[model samples]
Target: MRFNRSSCDKCLDVCPVKAIWIDDQGLHIDRDACTGCMLCNSICPADGLSIQNFNFQSVLAKLKDLQSPVLSCHVVADNQAHIKIPCLGLLSETHLAVMSILAEAPVQLNLTACKKCVNGVVVNKLQKSLFAVAAKLMNGSAPKIKLIEEKADLHFRPISYTRRGFFDALRHMDFPETIGYSGGLPAGDKPKAYADKAVPDKIKMLNKILPMLPETLKNWVYENYYYHLRVDSNCDLCLSCVMICPTGALKIGGDGSTGKIVFSSAFCNGCNLCAEFCSKNSIDIIKGFSGKNPSAYASCEAAT
Candidate 1:
């Protein structure tokens, strides 16, 4: 998450409305000011600060019913999409990739009305997320995407609802008590203490999606998403990585003698905390790891 306390303010940086910030009390969001453009959700490496949480099971169920699944932002969708989201900017590469895999067809994105919207920033973010999905595609072919950018497209914004109502219903929804703290409260209201316990949504999605990779593409997909950790004989068994890891991906296991590290690829969110905290420098992430620092991967091993 925060490699350093001052590092990794991605959600704060990407917000078009400048709705997010952090102070002594903790992170805060100007709820009323937040347009719910959702750029913050797809960009946060820690998977923190998602104002719109989707039920993927329901998404999948709907996806199966529509042979020609069309996805669009609420502004332009107007009953046109099988999946209508507040903004395409909120979608991560995992979302695009999963939908593509499930549909077994190009996932259509309606972008014809994007330039007309004040939230034009989402177009760029959506492009970048699509690019990320494309890179992991083993064939190095174009991503499974069909962009509906023609001006004549039938799926245009409707005038029934004003822009102000895009996410007005958020306050009335029955969600967790802490959900309201993400945004929509007065400036004086601070969020509850950071619940650093939940495994981010992206991590869960990655775990499930990897297993669905076709046999031929599976190895290449693993190289793109997972890492292998190596440990040298010099390890002190300090287990600092285990302590610092936000996800319990790394552990040490043994019967009676000669303990060795165990890594669960499913839980690793690619935070690379274990690589940074290793005092021995014995941890080396061999491949498939990318971070702010090229050198800080893991013990004699690769990062997952």
Candidate 2:
């Protein structure tokens, strides 16, 4: 996965197993535990993570030469001698569910070992989430999906840490304290609320009167610093964006009227998270009103 340091952790969210992690040295992939499943590229919000792409026809021809049968799967395996596909974030829960029904052989996913990957967060997410979804569909039974990390005796090449750090800083100029991937919440059945609704007057008047509301709610109403974008015209009003926003900023609300995407910048950290993964390309990242210069946070925010 190619990740800008600002929010490279996108890979950490998809792993079926908790094989991906970050530290002062940066992201690491535990090759021994990774299940080469390319799920990380599928779910990454940045569309940065990817696996080596193997042409399906070529792979099929090679399998024929080996006298082995083709493997039918909804997921792809990560290997070095493969084509370049963006991170495993491309896959979804439905893809995993379908794999459970189509394949019969014990499935194996070959992924990067710790030493071989610069983008460990992306690889790790692919492993964990695949396992979680597989377990649910298989009723706790072993999934056809299996994890395997690749081993390559390669040497570390030196590069300028200063240059890397500089560019990373630029991308994260407006980011929050902690951005990228969600975890620690257990599954539940609570009914979720999407974009917050408001009466027609509330809709038209909120932006104009934002400075007049209570401090606590003022930012909430105007989405002060948080960046928001319109759902594409194709948006089925899926409300998925409402559900996935970590800050509880976007919500579905309206008056017998067409529902709208409401946002609260009070809780936003100026993370370009919502815009990164938007399938519709309707969102854009812009500066939020933090009442201070953006450089202040850029200088002070902790590095991941």
Candidate 3:
């Protein structure tokens, strides 16, 4: 979920409005300046920039009622039965993959007006990348989703929240009692803290979606969705990889006298940070995910 050492600036690169920025503490959104276009949310690999109101859960729930779901941004004219989002750029691979697995009919993304939109270029790229990854996961199986330019004519209706709904929301507010220092630390730190405490959203979504896929696709996803690490004979058991792993997928420990390194496939996002930091070139990343748990004991001399 978190890549502390990651120099990935995909979100920053995609924002057409320059409303998002990263500092020492991490990614920050200038909400007043942001139009809620959701370009950053779509491209963020860490699942970091989500709009509170338009989340995957809500989208999924909406899909349950429609046989053919069309997702469109506000700029587009509403279709008869489409689920409208703030921006098509908000839909990530996880969202598309999950929709494909759960929806009975093909999912259509209405991008009829994207070319004229200010965020068109990034939106186009995001959709293409998500489509490519989804197709790869399906092993060339016909994708049950599509991106197309088709306009529909319909009016938008605003949802009115009831008094009880408003009151319930008030009960769930997470407001701090007092304002403190605005910003100083890097935004990566928050994600790092979260990674230390919970599984990344991608992994969690993959686990849920895998079971629903066909057997071949399921196996393929399990095999290709993760990055596998191998320790060779050259490994000096320095345990540097363990310490460098951002997701805590790789861990090191000892029985006081003996040291060992263990890897949990569940946690690895395949960022290659561990392999990158290994000084001995001792770690090799297999392209596919491993079915077996990964563990290795340090050579006795290295443990000493």
Candidate 4:
């Protein structure tokens, strides 16, 4: 968000309801008109937007036990979906990719209620993101997402397991515990400086799920979802990059040294603020995964 070299209009372009605007005070949202579609959050490379009701972690936890997963929007009543999201647009590429990776079969997505829903505009965004996820997560092979649109005003019936089968399947599955993702300060506590600018919870959750993926798929996750840094000798450990980094992706951390700058691909968020603000012009980013720990991978040592 602090990157001022060039302005970004990605959020404005994707807001289906036109609830976002900008002025001298910075970005503003018309909460009254905002439909909470979350297309802006999904599209923002820098994560400049925030939404309190977007809860995909709980949805993902429920899908983990099911061999085959079907997701639908909440507008669809009596749906056979394994779980329902507020809207399909709430899912960014990262969420969809993670879901597909965990499921054994193609992830069935029911968009049958879009046409009749007020938030139906997100359907276009959903289609684009799903295709992108398929290319990266499945290597452009058979589509990972099987979208079920309305057929002659009639929705396709997905195979819904009996409640007994649901509980029984849960028992046989050797699954780990659910992703109990909860964060925030205690009751009335307030955030200190730059706390909100730190690494996002979603990125943390993605790394938490990494170990569960197969070896081959893990490698793909590194190459696609993550990124690395390339620093030249111009860096003098001035600590500018680390301080300016909104996501805490760049930090003066090492195995056991003071003059080392660590880079975490998972927390980078593709903001490029570190490189843009670097006075020495020493830092460069190598996009795509670096085949290392996305959470904590050392790139170059700072000049002592």
Candidate 5:
């Protein structure tokens, strides 16, 4: 699913790789080591995920529709389509692996148009690495991989009317204007926050594993560690949280999996979209940094 405040980041929370994070733009994903279980997509609340160019059935049809270099196609669904982003750079390798297996098609990630991807060249390299691993994992039954480059107009409607308007959007988003053209904050030689705290064994283990993860999952882990949420026992299995979550992070499984909602941090963006939609007043959106943001926190944390 497309990562955004409109979606949930449950997948981001559970990912061992800490591949997910929320930025001013939206959810960013790192593709390496994603494993493609698609548990994240299934758990997403918004159903915001749609395979980039084709639906499930169409992907299945590709197995029979193959011709020349066209083996199987990997279609990505990324929410960051607004800027100059590449198609292949949209999802992590785990997402692609899920597509390769479940869709029964060799993945053909399209990156031909990413010459100036807003996400950058690093994303392109990640796509290549993940594809290789995915191909190897496919065994002898692997599908063909193809890179199709093409450009489609990004339908970014101007949030403002003029140059001042551009600054206005930044101001509204609370973004620093003087920072480098690279979308990050201004660089300084100051020490980082909370870097020298006493480390628990569990936290130490997490730190050791952090660098090995895909970017998307990594960010998710960091964000959840910084901003967390919870579900209370008062939940009524209403599926309200599931329906409202944009990224499918809140899942209501069949066979009473819905009896208790499963909150996957990997898929949550901490946007509080689910908290706003709950009927029984059973969900809470807490800040990972402070444990709860009073402006967005709810009393009872519910699930399923």
Candidate 6:
């Protein structure tokens, strides 16, 4: 959504089939042409793309049953020992880091078929980069999450649901249509602009995993994994950055006479919207992680 800020075109560039594109209206994906390869979903820094049926929590749930877990794409031959994902590229650094900490043994990522697949080249590179980052964030002592090219021995079993089961599921559904209301405004309330409430799931995952990492690794991630913004004295409080921030990471507040800008590093995905939009060039993006201080580098005074 902040595509205008950093001019990010990662999703468009990575589409193996050229299913993604951009225009004045914003990003667009041709669902009919999308192969569900998920390369775009994995590489988007802002978590802009998502797979409809892939529940990350469910994948984590499955990990509880295994001693040594191997993750591979469904395109790869499945083995009973390995947990298959729709695409190997779906796993982000946060996903890998969490799995590494939760597993009893080293995590194996199968990428043997990636080299030959249309989506494999970019995904293979991404897998390696994310693995390296996850490993570094865990310190040297962290379990080795290796990328293996060897084929696995696996099987697949399909489950079928009965008519009665389907009926039972329908019986429990809370249908929104059941709310007896016609299309009319409330008695006193007025319509307002829609506010985006969706926070990137990756951010939530990162927050949970950060505390479990080794102190040294945690420090490194905080210093390097996130982007920090610094507001210099050149800022005239135009508030352009605040309005453009997709994640609500930048905020402006105060009375008409005085105002201040505040930032929360935890919410920033380093899209560089503020820095890029600043007409005065007062905002600078600092690469790496900042500590718990939300106001660090982002606090600035302005006259309204």
TM-score (all chains, Cα) for each model:
0.71, 0.28, 0.67, 0.76, 0.28, 0.72
Could you tell me which 10 consecutive residues in candidate 1 have the lowest summed lDDT? 290-299
Cα lDDT of model 4 by residue, 225-283, tens digit: 77778788778888888887788888776554656787878788776767888899888
lDDT of 2: 0.41
lDDT of each: 0.61, 0.41, 0.60, 0.68, 0.42, 0.63
- Model 3: weakest 10-residue lDDT segment is 176-185
Residue 276's C-alpha lDDT in candidate 1?
A: 73
Candidates, ranked, TM-score: 4, 6, 1, 3, 2, 5
The better-scoring model by TM-score among 3 and 6 is 6
lDDT string, candidate 3, 30-103, tens digits: 76666556667666644566443334565666566566666666554533334565666667665666666677
Which pairs clash in the backbone of model 6? 78-154, 79-154, 222-289, 223-288, 223-289, 224-288, 224-289
Reference-based TM-score, model 2: 0.28
lDDT preference between candidates 1 and 2, better one: 1
Model 3 residue 28 distance off true place after TM-score fit, in angstroms: 6.2
Residue-wise C-alpha lDDT for candidate 1, range 84-202, written one tens digit per residue? 66677767776776665666655678777777776678888777766776777636567766667665653433324356654553443334321422323223423333224456676
- lDDT-superior candidate, 3 or 6: 6
The TM-score, computed over Cα atoms with residue i paired to residue i, of candidate 6 is 0.72
How much is the lDDT of residue 125 in candidate 3?
Answer: 65
For model 3, what is the alpha-carbon lDDT of residue 181? 16
What is the total number of backbone clashes in candidate 6? 7
Q: In TM-score terms, which candidate is top?
A: 4
Ranking by lDDT: 4, 6, 1, 3, 5, 2
